[model samples]
Target: MVFVQYTVLGIFFLMELCALAAFSYWGFHLNRGWFIKILLGIGAPLLVAIFWGTFIAPKASIPVSIPVRIILQLIIFALAIAALYFSSKSMLAVVFLVVVVVEMIIMYSMGW
Candidate 1:
């Protein structure tokens, strides 16, 4: 049981990393100048990292209730899925969404 819980947590961490990558991927694929691409590709994930560290991380600077935290997480995941979809990775987006939904269900059931 402990191992399963830890595994789920690890998967959640991977999902977070995937969200950042989705942002970067979307930014890079935009039909814009190289400079703009570079800025957004780097900046989007940087801003997200800052926000997550500040409010959503395990040791967040400004902690919120679990429900709020879950909502914030879902928003991020949704944005990531949208990013992938708009970037022409519809299959990947669907897969990510399914994984996120399943993981969220497990996480909630496990009280994590």
Candidate 2:
């Protein structure tokens, strides 16, 4: 059970990494000018970091109830998956979504 907890935590970390990567990928591949690309490449992930720090991190500044937190997590992960799918990586998006669902189920069932 402890091992499962640690594994779920690791999954959370991986999910965060995937979100940042998806945001970066979307920003950098914008069909706009180089300046816009650079701005978005930095700005998008910065915005997500701010949001996560404020509302979703372990030490969130403004923490919500567990249900709300889980909902927020799902929304964020869904966006990341959508980003991947729209960026022409549908298979990867599906895989990421599957992994996220499994992690969420385990976390919830284990009361993490």
Candidate 3:
């Protein structure tokens, strides 16, 4: 089960990388703004964080400390909403929203 999970996640990450690469290429070709690129970079880790916390970590036997976890969750959520609230462009907000959604999805999935 662990091996299968790893394989699936590996593929998912690879897909994300490919999408990032394509975005980079498109950015270079079209000269999209810097914020857009940065937003894309942020999305990658956020996705992993969300996936692991939600889909993977809960199955582990040991209990994670709730207070610290809650703090971290709030931080991510704030970043997501903050990016939207502060900025005019869609890319930043969208990227952060993706992160926020991923985090929430995992938390919800694990019944946290």
Candidate 4:
């Protein structure tokens, strides 16, 4: 039973990480262009969340519903992805990565 809990959170952890990576490393921020910002800010993480949770996270028994969990996950993950998309340099990317890590930590530890 304990293993199941850890496994579920672990799956969420990695999915969160990928969202972080997509935003932080691939297609993060978008201050320069409005349309692109909307594209990455909303699209990338939504698609990734659906794909990752559907295909991979199930191995750990995470929820398949997009509406599950706190609203913050959607906001944070999507924003992180957007930030990653628009980031002009590695520093910004790293900041977004740190944000995701911190958010995950708080969610896991105390729902802090």
**Candidate number with greatest TM-score:** 1
Answer with 3 or 4, whichever has the higher TM-score: 4
* Candidates in descending TM-score order: 1, 2, 4, 3
**Which has the higher lDDT value, candidate number 3 or candidate number 4?**
4
Of 1 and 2, the candidate ahead on lDDT is 1
- Give per-residue CA lDDT, model 2, range 1-112, as digits (tens): 7887897899889889899899888888888999998998888888888999899888999998899999989988898898888888899999999999988897888888
Question: What's the TM-score of each model vs. the native?
Answer: 0.98, 0.94, 0.34, 0.38
3-77 per-residue lDDT for model 1 (tens digits): 999999999999999999999999999999999999999999999999899899999999988999999999999
Error of 3 at 48 (Å): 6.1
Comparing candidate 1 with candidate 3, which one achieves the higher lDDT? 1
Q: By TM-score, how accurate is candidate 2?
A: 0.94
Each model's lDDT: 0.96, 0.88, 0.50, 0.58
TM-score, predicted candidate 4 vs. hidden true structure: 0.38
Worst 10 residues of 2 by lDDT: 1-10
Cα lDDT of candidate 1 equals 0.96
Give all candidate RMSDs, comma-separated.
0.6, 1.0, 9.1, 9.9
Which residues of candidate 2, in runs, are more than 4 Å off?
Answer: none
Tell me how candidate 2 scores on lDDT: 0.88
